[model samples]
Target: MLLKYIISHTRLNESSVKNTIKLLNEDCTVPFISRYRKEATGNLDEVQIGDIVKYKEQFEILEKRKIAILKALEEQNVLTQELKQKIESCIDLITLEDLYLPYKKKRKTKAETARKNGLEPLAKIIMSQKANDIESIAYKYINKEIKNVDDALEGARHIISEWINERTDIRNSLRNQLERHAQISTKVVKTKAKDEKAQKFRDYFDWSESLQRIPSHRLLAILRAEKEGFIRVKINIDDVRALERIDNRIIRSNNTCADQIELAISDAYKRLLFPSLSNEALSKAKEKADEAAITVFAKNLKQLLLGSPIGEKRVLAIDPGFKTGCKLVCLNAQGGLEHNETIYPHPPKNDSFAAIKKIASLAEAYKIEAIAIGNGTASRETEALVKKIQFKNNIQVFVVSEAGASIYSASKIARDEFPNYDVTVRGSVSIGRRLQDPLAELVKIDAKSIGVGQYQHDVDQNKLQKELDVVVENCVNAVGVNINTASIPLLSSVSGIGPKLAENIFNYRNKYGVFKSRKDIKKVPRLGDKAFEQGAAFLRIKDAKNPLDDSSVHPESYKVVEEMAKDEGVTLGELIGNEKILQKINLKKYETQTIGLLTLQDIIKELKKPGLDIRESAKVFSFNQNIKSITDLHTGQLLPGIVNNITAFGCFVDIGIKESGLIHVSNLSDEFVKDVNEHVHLHEQIIVKVLEVDVSRKRIQLKLHKK
Candidate 1:
């Protein structure tokens, strides 16, 4: 039953969902199943597998809620066979909640007070809509609780309102109306309108838009404004039309009882129904907006994490600044900090000659093959200074983004890694290491702090973290980890390894020696068979005795590859990377029940490019020398820029300035732009024509340059 619902909801293959769920239940990770268990999942990618996991968990939560509702109904002695079946078969939370609404516990309210006054019977008589003289019927119920016939009728109306509110048909009708016709409107709090902190949200002070048509970023902005006491947000619809819809569902004739029912419907619509449904409508919209924002954030994070890496080389990295001077650190090929110092080359002391000599001497002494300068304060001056020096070796200079570097440097992780160093030196090291390998160095910092997201802080934190964690795991496993050199943070992102297990592996390696092969990880305490099965394939060991250990071929498939190698009359080392021989081998001959053509094909592909880095090598990028700041910009000027951040509406470009420039979606192309990512990617270098400049606001508007 749950499987059918998941299939209907997700539109995924039944067999694939079933197999993926089974693997998930048995503790297999998404990366492991997608990479090594393709046969079981019909070649579903990580995204599809993740969808299955999501729906399966949702189904479990629904079922658990059903059980809780049933238990409560039985305890109340209101459980009927028909109602039990209805609750048991309900698929969604909203529907199930509607069914259980009448029985839900409530505090002291008008309806409860009316029931205590013995007016429920009179209310039921009015609901029947047959009695013409309802005042006389109400008179019989009058006592100390009800002083007059009008008072008795009002009490009965309150009871009737509760009944109307509890009706599933009525609630569903109102929900449909709210879903289709709700408009979200906001108004300025008069006092906050003049507040300085409220100026960012000034545009939304008197805004109104269809809830369905509003963009996610705009919705989040309005919500944040309301949350911060700058504005009052309300979800509204045509009240008269809404009330008429409820009336048509309840009222039967033009009699006194029908009139009483009409009055009750009005009370219900005003006091109970519309307010509840309107809030629900706003909450649902916020949820959808959050989902869209999180998806954008996750995509941006994946691109940033997988950004180009300049492979292992001796590098001198600089964290540029003005008042504080530039912090410089020399990192060896393995990204270990060899030396550190400060240089004031730009201003204050005007020590350009001494700073230049010190940098040149350091570069030559450390045998620096590449230079990484952080794209921050005084970055242009630093780059210019570095370019003037004539070096012995042709050292490539790259302006690496320093987003989240300061946060990571000041964090406990940095303190643990560099106990004696200050935040400045640690930040400089991070700049250099990120240039060497982004995935390895970035896993230590919080992704939200990386500055690639749109309205990241406004979205649901738990949901964002979950999604980003999955993306990190996929990216980490996609580019297989070097078992010997991977840091604890990097290893912790592996398929089944958590922080504790990663620490154990690191301690084991440190106490004993480096991991010689993938199999050596099994010796670490608490590293069980399950962890090994899920993680081993994503770990690489260089110069191992078994050449396949350096590749992504799982240990379980070792025998299959070995068989293929034996048939080819060569060793595993000789058979690997021999595409000519690999392609000639018949895959059908090696197919087993567990290992089908899909698995065989993957095995062959892995043998071809064993443990190849899936990312491009980082290239040196220099911003236009003339455009140093916003004041240097003008309209119709073509300039080179790098896409630093992507949002739902557009992408922000870094044009060698402290403030990034925005390229709205409309300016991206002549055609309609659906997704910003399709036109540009994070860190993509491109040429843009300046469209407008608001120098006072530090805003630069650009359009993609075609020529």
Candidate 2:
């Protein structure tokens, strides 16, 4: 399998790949692996393992689906062993589905019943085109069983026609050709309903376009428009044109009967082949939608994983709501919330000034370097109010994504953190901490609540959630954490450190003392040797017992590194950070295929800059006080936005508005899109322009350019 090949070729270890396959088979969650299995996986973090697991799963699914299709064909007595083997060898689902096209179940057709009667030979005679007399063949089958001329012709045609269509290989060939050549057509027509509701599909009137060129967002929109009775959709493909090749074959293969066979082939295709093939193209388009959607989601995650962080700074965060006012939490440099408050700035609009006054006072007293504003209801208004106050220089304001703030606010972790406060306070703390450490804060909430992907709820939740969790785990492990300061929740995502071990680590810290070195982590209760192996590299001990121990160097490979450093006549720390010197090490000297060239290469890279955080440096983003309402939007004005959600169509970016604007997938980039995610993703700050604004529906269409 390609997945196995990739695992073998990549720098990622073989045991990690094997364990991922096993864990995926057992349906153990990504969080489970990242949190629990350290040593067994060589402390391979969630992201790398997740990537492997996902690829393995996709390969497995494609393989099994192929088998299922082959079994179905076998049941119909249409599958040969050679054909079965060929199907099994297929790699992609598209190819597998194409192979199964003819054997697929469908409504009962005239062809099957016609074969039950005795008119097959007469049908063959007409189809043979060898018939010097068409009436003579028709006469032979004219009886009560074969019935009249109409019945006899119908029965004969049905039998011969079905046999011709049963050539699954030809069906497979034609489907591929048709999908590439097809066009989708749609029309909007009036329906019976109240006012404009009935005319929902009226926008698609007279739309016609190539299927290949259609954007995912537009396709999903049109499908939805049709579903709402706003349009009638149809897909057009040159199936007859595609089958022309097959027709020529039948005619060329059987010379004397060529003309008759050609006619029969044409009739068979015209009556049955074209419609089925066109529909098949439509089905394939939908599959493309799913693949596109997943691809976009993956891109969104990539961006989110790469999102910048607000370096060690005290931040005052506010979670705005209707009845709840603004929940405020002040988080220290280590992401521990030092204080909480709920000050009403709107609704009970009388006390709005007081809330702003308190925010400024707290900022001054705490020496807060940043103000993290949650992008939720009343958020814009609250931000506008806060901007009115004069803060000391360098206290930046950030409109943070408050996605899943409520979920974390209501979680047990939140409760434990603020047992004496309200849920709103917990939510505020979550918002503040999210800006400080997204991966850390996010892990405390359910992956689904992060709200980064499209149709997330509608898709197979089990699969989607699992994949998303894996994405999160991979992101978390890619960037190591400070064990001394990390919350138990954050520690839980470390490879080999599950919830139980996270608790143990923290508990051990609370009892014995804070760990001053990476080696001391093994002493944490329930942290087995296997767990230590996977967890240690990703858990940094700044100012630890050994400087190299604080780096990403795995403990198992410590000796090799020490030996290399010794040969270089330098300490491990000096050798590790010496990029020029480290690059010269010979791979053969590593002397083990178990740790291949790829692994050696990764090690060398890490040695140059150990404990490298994959995240980008944070930027200061402030909400515009003057433009607080949708009505304030100008046609070509450029604005900053945080990508809140991504769909196959495009990214939904919140620009401090009540509702986010849609940057149509078509507007995503100048490049032709096989995947939307390649251009943009979640939590990414992007520039956009207001293309169209509809106040009535609260809809704002946006384009991705600095207009």
Candidate 3:
């Protein structure tokens, strides 16, 4: 039953989804199932598997709600056989709630009071559409409390209003009308018009747009403004059309009873239905907007995490500053901090000769192969100063992005790693290590603080955190982790090793030297077979006893590889990377009940490049020498830039200036660019033509260069 629902919702093959669910229910992780059980899942990727898991969870929640509702209805003695069946057949939460609303218990209302006063008989007479004298019927029910015909008729109308509000067809029709035609508008708060903080929301002060057509970012902005008390937001629809739709569903005749019913319809819509449905629509819209924003954030984070690394190079990193001296740290090829110092290369000090002497001496003394300067405060000056130093050994200089360096400096992770050092020293080390391996170092910091998102804080925090964690997990596993050298945070991102297990593994490594083989992980306390099965493939061990340990080949599949090497008349090491022998072996011959052609093919590929880093090597980038700030930019001049952040509307490029330039979607290519990632990526360097520059506002506009 659940399989059909998921297949219908996702429009995927039923058989594949069924098998994927089976694997998931067996306690297999998404990464493990997608990578190892490819044949069973029909080669579905992690995204499809994730969707299946999400929808299954949603259905489980709905089922639980249904059980609770059934229990409530049964307790109230209103659970008829037909109503029970109708509730069980419901597939949508909104429709199910609408069906159950009439039976729900509530506080004392005007309708309930009227019913208590013996006016329900008159309401039923009016609803019958056969009563020609509603006033007479209402007068018959009038008691000492009811003064006149008008008072009695008003009581009947109130009862009828509740009836109209509870009718399923009337509620559904009115809801559909509002969803299709509602417009959201905002107005500035009159009293706070002159406030400076409120002025930032000026764009939304007089904004009005169709709720259905509003973009996610704009909706979030207006909602944020409303939340901050800068503006009042309202959702409106054409009242005449809305009333006509409700009246058509409720009124059956033009008699005296129909007149009272018309009044009841208007009261129901204005007082009860419209407000409730409009709020529901707005809540749904907000959820969709949050999902869209979170998806974009997840994509940007994946790119940033998988960014190219400069790999294992001895680096002298500088955290540039003007007031305090520039914090410098010298790191070895293994990313361990060897030395740290402070140098004043800019501002009041102007100690150029001394700074140059110190840098050159460090390069020669530490055998530094590259220089990584944090792109902050005095970055340009530091880059220029470093470029002039004449080192005996060749050194490549790169200005690395320090988006979350400050956050990481003060984080508990940094404090634990560098107990003796201060924040400045820790920050320099993060900058240098990011250049060496972006994925490993970035896992230690929060994904939101990386600054590659739009309105990140406004989105759902739990959803954002979950999506970003998935991206981090996938990237960490894709690149594979060297268990011996990886940090606890990096190890925690592996497929099956969570925070607790990661701590255990770290402690085990500390107690007993380095992990000698993939199987050695099992010896750690609390590390069970299931954890080893899920994580062993993604963990690498260099110089292990078994050559396959360093590759992505699972230990369970080691026998197949051993058999292949035996058939090829060569040792496992000789058979690895030997294309002639690997190609000569028939993959189908090794297939068994558990293994298929897909898994066997992956094994062959892994043998070719044992434990290869899937990411590209980082390259040094130079910005346009003439431009350093917004004031230096001119219209129509072509300049080199690197894409710093991307959004649905456009991409922001860093053109060697403090202020990044915007490349709107329309100008991304000669053809219409639907997805910005298709044209550029995070940290991608490209040439752009400057189109406009607003120095006062500090905004630059540019167009992508045509191929």
Highest lDDT model number: 1
- lDDT per residue for candidate 1 within 606-632, as digits (tens), equals 899888889999987878998877999
- Which lDDT tens digits does candidate 2 get at residues 1-707? 75455475456877777766676566555544554444446667656765676577677788779768877887899998787887977777766775675678867778666766677777667655665666656777776676676687767767766767767666666676776777888876544333476454444666888887786556766777666666788877665676688776565444434544665677777777667776767766766775566556655765665577887899999887767577888888887778877888788555877887899889988889988888888877777777788887567887787778888888888888789888877888888887887777777877766777665543445656656655665666777778887788878877778789999998898898878887798888778776786678778888876777677766767777788888889987688678789878786687463455555666788888887777887787654556677898877877887678877667687888777888977877777765556676566678888888887777788888741
lDDT of each: 0.92, 0.73, 0.90
For model 1, the superposed segments whose C-alpha errors exceed 4 Å read none
Backbone clash total, candidate 1 = 0
Q: Residues 134-221, candidate 3, lDDT per residue (tens digit)?
A: 7777778778878888888889898998988898998888778767889999999999778888987888889889988888888898
Better candidate number, 2 or 3, judged by lDDT: 3
Order of quality (lDDT) = 1, 3, 2
Instruction: Report how far residue 626 has shifted in candidate 2, in Å.
Output: 2.0
| Alpha carbon RMSD to native, model 3 | 1.6
Query: Each candidate's root-mean-square deviation in Å?
Result: 1.1, 6.0, 1.6
